[model samples]
Target: MTFQYSRSFAHQLDEQDTLKEFRQWFHFPTNAVGEDQLYFCGNSLGLQPRTAKQALDAELEDWAKHGVEGHFHGKNPWFHYHKFLTQHSAEIVGAREHEVVVMNQLTVNLHLLMVSFYRPTASRYKIIMEAGAFPSDMYAIESQVKFHGFEYDKAVIELKPRDGEHTLRNADILDAIEQHKDELALVFFSGVQYYTGQLFNIKQITEKAHSVGAIAGFDLAHAAGMLTYNCTIGM
Candidate 1:
């Protein structure tokens, strides 16, 4: 089913939206000529919340007032600041607080996960991923394979859409797993394909990988915040 949009339609939507009042909580950018630009880049970087300034100012005030003791005594203590962010983050990813941590940037965390999960064995040491994964993920996986003393070409297997197709079929992915069952060690794919916006059937893929005695994981950068679902369904 296709949908159409126009200024009038958008206005109607804005009028009916329950969260319309929350629009006042942002600072949308204006052009040099002082006109508000129609910003459409939230997929890259979200607009700053209007509350951010007040939040930061409060933190600054706490720091100035408490100095070294602010780590434990501030209104929002710096010592456990990241912990405060974790509950919401866990809810976003559909994970337990213990399973999630806000640490390094995306690729850095990917590399760290690879170190723990990419334990290649002698007979089954191959890692499968999407053909056009984000460059950072590709680089991280390549480096991980090399770090574990495997050649890039031999260690990494990239699944591509079949000829004349733009998106991968679930059957194709299952076939790849079946074909390489003996050699496959890990099956990792993006939860959502960044380019095509394809949300992979994560539960199905994970089940297939497990059936083939392979470990499965996902990069959830694109899937989070836009959709409501449970990650626990796959497991």
Candidate 2:
């Protein structure tokens, strides 16, 4: 059935939604007059959940009562801190529990992933990326190539749209990967382009990279919680 495009239709759908109760769990900002505001910037910073405060308070109580023992004795132990997130994170990203881990911020994770996957050989030394990537990615890749004794310009292949175009075409991306296949050691792209908000063809991109013997990696800072796609990292 086609979804009707009206406020009443939206409200009807919301009323029918099984997960509607979850919406009340999130904390929304309100104006001075106490009207709830519509927020569209979750892409940048997600709003704090109402339950988060209670969870945090419980942790504080544990710390006050147990001190360092809280690491082992708390409701969610700090000793295996990352374990708390693994299964849920895996489900969100559509991966196995063993295939995912939560760590530092986006840049730190990018550097860590690149450290293992960005190994460069004499012939296969180039990295293919979007023309205007998030700043952290551009910096990390540049520094990585330079650390391996290759000049930035020669070692990094950035794919840009044709003149008068704002976003990349899939054909152009595939062609670029094929054209640079011999030199490409890795194909790194944003899961969703931050500037253009473009969701890439992840599966085809990975296949192309593998066909040409290049490892594929993705920066999912913007993609996670925004949409679902199958992604293989460090392969």
Candidate 3:
């Protein structure tokens, strides 16, 4: 069979997509010459929505109009500001409102999550991750393990793809989990591998981790908005 994914076909697909309206909400940037540039790096920094300026203006107006009172009295009170984003974020992550909190930046969030979830005892004190996880995640895990007084070699396990393979197979991952069942404390993986764009079998991996008495979590920067996966449902 021949593949049909040309620009015209993609535009046609966009025409029929239910989320077509959302495209209008974003402010896709153009090149210096005024041509719309292909933007495939939303995984890093997303395109700003056209309404962002207006939103910022509203916040500035609040600050100007209310000063310190803006914390409680402004149109968008800073006191409850994060709460406004919480419900939408919870829905996106497939979590209960109480289970989700939007506070810091991505790596900061990862570190905070690890503080609660990566509790390592003498016996089960190892954190397992994919070999080529994002640099920020790698740093967070490494520092957390070292901070807990465990040697890097003993505290962190990196799972590599088999020889000649560009992506990991589900069996290989599960096998690794089985091999380290007794020593594993947490299994953390990117929801989608950033470089290869391979989506891990998060639910299955999480199930195996739980079966072996390990906590499981994911860094979802690449996967969010691209596809829907439910962590709560998987749990």
Best candidate per TM-score, number? Answer: 3
Pairs clashing in candidate 1? none
Cα lDDT listed for each candidate? 0.85, 0.87, 0.86
State the lDDT of candidate 3 residue by residue for 1-235, as single tens digits.
3448798888777788997888778888899999877888876788999989999999999999999999999788999888998888888877778877778798998888888888899999987889989998999999999989999887888988889998989898899899999999999998899988999989899999999999998888888667787555322
**Candidate 1 lDDT, 1-235, residue by residue in tens:** 2345788777787798998898788889999999877878776688899999999999999999999899989799998887988999888878888877788798888887777777898899998889999989899889888888999899888999989999999898988989999999899998889888898988888988999999898888888767777555212
Which residue pairs collide in model 3, if any? none
What is the lDDT for 123 in model 2?
Answer: 100
State the lDDT of candidate 2 residue by residue for 152-218, as single tens digits. 9999989898999988899888898999999999999988998889888888888999899998988
To one decimal, what is the Cα RMSD in angstroms of model 3 from the true structure? 2.3
Query: Which residues of candidate 2, in runs, are more than 4 Å off?
Result: 1-19, 230-235
Q: Quick one: ranking by lDDT, best first?
A: 2, 3, 1
Off by over 4 Å in 1: 1-5, 233-235
- Candidate 1: Cα lDDT at 17: 94
TM-score for all models, in order of appearance: 0.88, 0.87, 0.89
lDDT, candidate 3, residue 70? Answer: 96
Model 3 error, position 72 (Å): 0.6
